[model samples]
Target: MAFLPTTKEEMQEQGYEQVDFIYVLGDAYVDHPSFGCAIITRTLQAFGYSCAILAQPDWHKDEEFLQFGTPRLGFLVSAGNIDSMVNHYSVNKRRRDQDAYSDDGIMGKRPDRPTIVYTQILKRLFPDVPVLIGGIEASLRRLAHYDYWDDKVRRSILIDSQADLLMFGMGENTIVEVADALNSGLAVQDICYIRGTVWKSKTLDMIVDDYILLPSYEQVRTDKRAYAKSFMIQYENQDAINSKMLIEAYEGWYVICNQPPLPLTQEQMDFTYSLPYERTFHPKYHYVPAIEEVQFSITSNRGCFGACAFCAITSHQGRVISTRSVESVVAEAKTITQMKNFKGYIHDVGGPSANFSRPACDKQQTHGACAKRQCLWPTPCPNLKVDHSHYVDMLDQVRALPNVKKVFIRSGIRYDYLMYDKDETFFDRLVQHHISGQLKVAPEHVSAPVLDKMGKPRKELYLRFVDRYYEKNKQFGKKQFLVPYLMSSHPGCDLNSAIELACYLKKIHHTPKQVQDFYPTPGTLATCMYYTGLDPRNMKPVYVAKTYEEKLEQRALMQFSYPKNYEIVYRALKKAHREDLIGNGPKCLIPKNKPKQNASFKQERAHRQKRYSKT
Candidate 1:
């Protein structure tokens, strides 16, 4: 269980003349199973492939990449846990001051586009060596899509980076298969049949028949409608069983993405987590801030059935929920209690959605998710099963373990799904034990049209959840608050819709402390809408707040209680022809300050003119 070799000295000590794979990461090396890099490198080690870490290498030159003297198999590149662009910049396109994934939480350790930069560096240094890219950055940008920072349609990362292959989703199965094939002396270009991966082919002869050909890169780049159309096709084919081989044409090459790898079963999920992870950052690094949040947490499940338009979980983790058994989760919890800095508290016991320990329904396992229909949207499907007793039992078991003080569920859950369940046992216990005063929930928006476009349930559903949450709090005699996470300037949200949301916030007597302006990152349905100005589902025209000022105005309206935000909220209301909202009435968002301010300004100007005339 020694750490992977990161330096030439370590490699020499380990007698590794040439490692099988050299993983170049954007973030500091944290050899925990929660990190994709750790799981991938550990899996390779399990398969007897020697892997070394070249984490956060300086991209200015290729000298830093030669530390391992070229990997025998290939070079694995990832932008750490988050996309590099997202890790480096905020939604406003401003450089972030801190990167939690870095040692000491410093910024600028990695370039803005780390995967492309590192891949280019490796390719230049070692012309014969193959480069493979995965992780969130490469996965979401595996195909040609919108770049929020560049504000243009960029080509696939595989083309830009010239990497041999792009492993898209969770790459446990794909990376192992890739390592084995490369070990067997298979050429990188010829290893095209692996699932959950994208590879470049020069000719159509390599492409299998009956594949759904997406709109060419040239087509999507030039035509907005084509981009939206292409997104819809890509969206529907995310299921493993029902997915077809997707082919997209470039100028002289074709990017062929194989069907996604099958989801891990319960046993497989347990085995994946059972790896001998140090469960901490590499000891060489003095401090890794990102580990503070998840070091004590456990990921009980993966994937999400609640497919929100703004989220990429459905694309990245798939729609089917794969969970570890209760025994495995409890064992992990016990191991956490024995950690050096154990505080007797487990931060989280969930994944994409905490409460989603099971599939949406029984048919999802065998039939695949309904192509056109959603499990939780419009309304919870009649076939949707909403059992939570298994999750409750698991939580109870972990809480009762020796040396365990309290188990908390900090990861977010689907409030609507909780409401759908006829059994309220988990809901009751959640309020009683799990929460820490204020529970953060994402309602996103309150306007029906905006909610519908965002793939969220209607306002009434959230309201009911709110009522019950507070009622449960009252019953427990614990004064807890519901901190609703709201978003502004999402696709399909105009000034009118923003005003509607502002009015709703007024009725609730709650001003959000934070309001996120929708950032159109790659591979989300909302991002497609943001770039195309049309809903991919029906190709309907959707209102998008494309201007920086308009986005600011919408965000200001969400937290209009701040004195600095009054002017923007007032202007937004005026522009939307809702001058009625500018008064002293209860329904008014802001007072008619200009009415008195203009008169004072005229009087002061008259006095100044009279004084100037006398002088």
Candidate 2:
């Protein structure tokens, strides 16, 4: 047989008139050649079950939908990528039992995309075809979930999405079995028998069979804000690890699907890394590239090593830097070069603090860098040695390819590790090839107490790097500058610290254009801080900008706090009879006249309730 037979040839061999099944899906990374979708889809193919990858579907446009496409035995509904994006997940932020403002977002808004809602339409159109759903989103939302902003418990999204069956957690293992059973002409409900899935009971009521819920993730409430906060905490802290599965006694006859399919073995990881992933992104959903600023996206690693107090990457992929070999990376780079717009560049070549590969440190201590949580969560067994030298060689090779322009490292790099350049370092070379005019780094905040609370270091370290950076920029006559990403009003950021940060930023001349106020996401250390006013990791009291007014002041400062912050500060000073240092001396970082509290959530809710009542 020919080494790589055409799709038609493979179809001929099957001797079947139709494909085994088709996949209507969603995942954080769509390039089927990279993530979990890659494994599941490829495995089905090996079993003679054909599959199509429909990344994030725009149900609004019937043309883009696949409800009427060729029928098959069944449809596998995977939500890890797409559902997670819609029902965004975060490792850290804040969580409240009640939500005062949660509602279906407006028309044309992203979170409200009609995929699941329209999946119901798919059911109407193809009434008999099975629509099985599974992935992180379905897994996490398998039961009645509390929406903090809405301040109400929302039903399982799996139920709402109208999937025939919902599976959860790392699904590489369960999906294969589901595919096999379907190919054998098994009933869709038969899939519920598999572990790691959620389906209806025989009683015709929702039966949420046990699905794996990482301890870190289970803590999150469904409010979108809480998810973001959770994400930030999970991304911080160099030595953070991952959380374990929880099997409870009180959920009622629930089977604890606590066993997440074991981490993808190296061979499986290699198979994914070697796929022709570059072309996997369906060009129809073109906005994906626009938002990412890259024609195509790729992944180098599946997980993160740094379990920051505010990040959730660990919660999703675990702390181990499960990676593909350099050879596999090279193969992917070759495919990316063949893109039609094939501008001589591979969009982004990294994931989760891209610079560090397979953490060199052990889980116990920090000789290198540890992404461990004090909670003894399963992080990369710290002693996992990272060989960045391979990356340097890979970047050099990628740039050397024909038509390959500057290979950009658009994925944010961990500034802390970049600063820890050993023996002249990989960062120096990384700067030349990957960084454009400026390397985008996330040194989230500058306040010491805030930094500690966020599992980050002080502002001095960021300054030290900046000083050295400017000196180099001047020496080389390179106008390339550094854009430092900052956040305000996180749990530890009080008005004073926010003001100090605003003033310090102005003094440095590198004022940020993008400023994020602390959004309390579910399952994050920072969110816990907002909820309890204490950093969970450090057990220290911290500032929580809980009230609307305080959140407003802190957020306003991040944007020049009214371009004339000094004026606001001056006014306050004058009112205190301390006018001596107004114009001639120290200026303030806050605005002179504070804006009136908008009370957006309260007003919006009242307005919505009134409108609903009118109806």
Candidate 3:
């Protein structure tokens, strides 16, 4: 019989449960391998225990019923799917009465910033219950981290959340061992010897399993400036894993291996994606006919090929994309379709880099995906290439099915790849069935130097892609338009690059009218650049964006299109003497309303100094 907790206090009093366990919190959306949630959720599932993923739980009210509903098993605490900055993002979305900033991503997510609040509440309600924390939010915040969004180096999230254990990296191997040991009546200290895990010993000392000593997940978070240097050094060929670092340790009866993760079978992959309540949380939707689940509840592909510097795809899932076959994906889709009170809308069918559908080319399959290297770092391995043709076809396959009308991309598709296509037919088809009128594409930047630093090609490619897109749209007389995603203050971005970006947006007769002040997610080459001003894996000079003055300039360039921003734009243009864009001379194209600096000058100055020195 599978393990089951006798009761809540048994869980709290037992120090840690054995094999019978419950993963308490994480992933408002179903986790995918391409995303960090994949490693944590799938690893536990791999060890032969039926798992329940509580995507989003109501914390304000008593949720003890949820704890009792599951078989008594150890509980896993995760927010990797939703980072702690859940509030930072949500607050940015809310246009404060007098505030100037906002957020992007057309899916319209104004998540309750109560991630930590909910986590803490769960702790209070389940006192003494074994809580294991792991995921980007928990992992990266496991140690003092430089928060670009906060402009401060903060302490470990474990210290903040009071979680018992915070496993880092891919949590499968470590989490399995953790559950087994606790279930076997082992102490937390016994599990510390395992690699890629962070746990407080019985004595309450933080013991990070550092066998191979990979950079802690905390080291991955950074502001914009450090990322510039990172961009210069990260490239494709540098792709390599230090096999010399491999080692194993104990987690109950099983061994935790730091070696490359074993490839998952298509059946296992299907089963993982095919999980039910684990994917959706809205029982209301269980009865109501809505467009989609109110919050996140998705089952998508495992990995993506696009290695955009700003993305964490390759690091989390390896550069080689691993996915269930399209038939498996369709089967999972059918499950959602068959759910009670099902709506015709299937939320999304994409992964880390949405349009990214294929896996490793050649080098990765032979050399092994570098857990440490980045495709956008020093350069892309000619081998670390992405072919979106398969994904485009996948989109077609999903949408053409019976009883499914729309499938949105909550994840952003790779615009650079789509724009690079030599044919117009794909564009036509995408507009027809897939886009349903408007779609969001991340071009990141338009300046050549900035794009180069960001590991993006140039503005020309995006423009070419845009032209082709519109050509098809005009031909079809369709209004399905591309909403360009623009990022400001990235590693290589500056006031000049922002201005250049503004110029390009004008050429295309478009205005994002929305700007993303780049949030440096953990585990990307860019985060290293944004941290140490060079890729920690390599050293190289790079441009940076961190100054308040420069940020305003970038915003002005974006605001040149919106007349409402004219006061700021006019003053900014006059100050910069770029009156060439003032009046009707020409339209400056860029997103409007960059976020306000939610900080004082001293803190901001400290950040600028720290960022500038690295650059």
Regions of candidate 2 where Cα sits further than 4 Å from its true position: 1-19, 25-43, 52-73, 78-131, 139-149, 152-174, 181-245, 248-257, 277-292, 360-387, 471-477, 528-543, 561-587, 590-615
**Best prediction by TM-score:** 1
* Highest lDDT model number: 1
Backbone clashes, candidate 2 = 72
lDDT of 2 at 30: 41
List, residue by residue over 298-393, the lDDT tens digit for candidate 3: 444555555567766544444555556778777766766776666777667766666656555556555656655554444445545545566666
* lDDT tens per residue, model 1, 296-360: 99999999989799999888989999999999999899889999899889998989899998999
**Could you give candidate 2's per-residue lDDT for residues 1-615 as a string of tens digits?**
111112333445646445656555543234454445656666566655666554445656655445336547766655434333324422222221221111112123323323365467567667788877655555545544433344444445555676677666556667777777777788886665564555653342343543233222234443434433333333332222232223221122332223333445546766755544434443333333222343445566666555466664544455555666776777777777776776676778788768766544454232323333332122223334545776677677777877777787877776655565553346566555566788777778877777777667667777887887767667656678788888877777776677667667767755676667665443345655666555545455666766765665666566653443444444434544544433433454433344454577458768867865664
Error of 3 at 359 (Å): 1.4
Off by over 4 Å in 1: 594-615
Q: Any idea what lDDT model 2 has?
A: 0.54
Poorest stretch of ten by lDDT in candidate 2: 97-106
Query: lDDT for each of the candidates?
Result: 0.89, 0.54, 0.54
Report lDDT (Cα) of residue 231, candidate 3: 30
Better structure of 1 and 3 per lDDT: 1
Error of 2 at 239 (Å): 14
lDDT, model 1: 0.89
The C-alpha TM-scores of every prediction are 0.95, 0.70, 0.69
